[model samples]
Target: MADGTRIVDLEAVPEDGSYRLTAEDPFGNETELILVRCDGEPGVRAWSNTCPHESQSLDVGDGAAIRDGAIVCPRHGSHFDACSGECDDGPAAGTTLPGVDLAVADGAVHLADDRYAFLHEGGIDDDEPGSTSHLSL
Candidate 1:
């Protein structure tokens, strides 16, 4: 087990929101991940930013909605356990968010997932399609 890439200090994680970051997989695919405060030894939990129901990003630049120790999906109001990534409500019930391995040590969170390499501190900004909502007058 490698030490992994250090992403952020545990103390810097928001107590009520999420810390978003981007990572690249071995296949050169970029994935957005969100880190949320959790209860237990690690003190942090990470999950892919996509919602299972529609694959929409859980965070839309503000941060994923978090409540009662769960990550609330912004698209359809699904609630996923922060630590377990298990959705128990909304359209995504019974589904789990893809998890990214992490290591918490010396007060910092490290990206320990062997399948991915840390890319940046936010979502990918490129030609990928996004929201298609019509502009309001």
Candidate 2:
């Protein structure tokens, strides 16, 4: 993860829709992030593709449906708010999905590729369960 590299093209992602991309943080932890355009909105929202309940990648295809402005995980029927990442149902209900810090700048989506840079700098190990690590977006 460098300082000025673009993560994903915002134009490539459909407006009022969702897309998935795989990224590797500085520590080599690979994570899938889902970028979604909230209904009738211009900016994009992002969340970890991994479901907290079973650590399975949420279905990002047709299985990922938008209902009431939330992205629904098809595997366990969990609905997450596209803007806030709040789980609305299923086993992980009330649990919030991890947010991928990103922003639109210079007409492109800029994501902090090194999600665990802070943790590593703070002497934290990224491989440990429940470790404070960052997600690549």
Candidate 3:
């Protein structure tokens, strides 16, 4: 995906919070990728915004909720650690979000944009606004 696509300006993303960005996946599916800023880490973190349980975008526009430093999936309330993508609660208890490789450069979060942005065609309605998305581990 062009080496490293700039996702967002670092200052625009709140420390200890998250932001959702859109991209075209390697498979050509319009996808949503999430950018996370954690105080415990030196740089930004990222993941495919899809929750495994129902293949729903973990973020439903308002952004995924950060609870105790973890990402709480909006679909079924599953909480996944933003740092490690580990899930410890909800229907996706043993699964983790698929991680995306990221880097910090020139005051922005740059990602391998389409690296992890993939999902099966089934149930995905490309015609719906922002209905495009991801698939996490």
Candidate 4:
């Protein structure tokens, strides 16, 4: 609603998964964000896609496993609250995922943080077919 870059339709985000998008900071660093339907007023929230425990991505294309309102880390299984991005029951407990500002209005999701500009509709490595994993597999 504030003339920010529109990222996606609100309904496009799967109820069980997240919508991935990339954004560039004012300094020109790109970061991936994961969007999920939240449980309250704004109805949507976003966090940097990295898990605090091992820096593993929360969503790996198919979607981050959402269970009981938390986004499960694909590598270590830590659960970050989809709404608050806080972890309270895993090795990543006491840590919070970095949040990316978002706004929902008129059935669309917009990049509301002035610090970031929307780059594209996927992760940083989406254009390349190489492994983003640290392990050489």
Which candidate gets the maximum TM-score versus the true structure?
4
- Output the lDDT of residue 94, model 4: 92
lDDT of 1: 0.85
How would you encode candidate 1's per-residue C-alpha lDDT over 1-137 as one tens digit per residue? Answer: 33999998888789888888889999999888989988865889889999989998988666788899999988789999988999988999999999888998888899999999998786676223332233457
Enumerate residue pairs that collide in model 3: none
Give the lDDT of residue 23 in candidate 3: 61
TM-score of each: 0.88, 0.69, 0.74, 0.89
Model 3 TM-score, all chains together: 0.74
Screening candidate 4 with a backbone cut-off below 3 angstroms (N, C-alpha, C), the clashing residue pairs are none
Count steric clashes of candidate 1. 0
Q: List, residue by residue over 1-137, the lDDT tens digit for candidate 4.
A: 54688988999888988988888898999888889989975788989889988889887766779999999998778888889998998789999999888888899998899989988887787754223344445
Tell how far residue 84 is off in model 2, in angstroms.
0.6
Per-residue error for 135 in candidate 3, Å, reads 27
Q: Which stretches of candidate 4 lie over 4 Å from their true place?
A: 128-137
Q: Which ten residues in a row have the lowest lDDT in candidate 1?
A: 126-135
> Where does model 2 exceed 4 Å of error?
1-4, 39-42, 60-63, 116-137
CA-lDDT, candidates in order: 0.85, 0.62, 0.69, 0.84
Q: Give, for candidate 4, the lowest lDDT window spanning 10 residues.
A: 128-137
Q: Write the per-residue lDDT of candidate 2 for residues 1-137, one digit (tens) a residue.
A: 32444656677565545666655677677566667776433377767777777776663332246677787766788888888888868887988889877767766766654472222111122344323355556
What TM-score quantifies how close candidate 2 is to the native fold?
Answer: 0.69
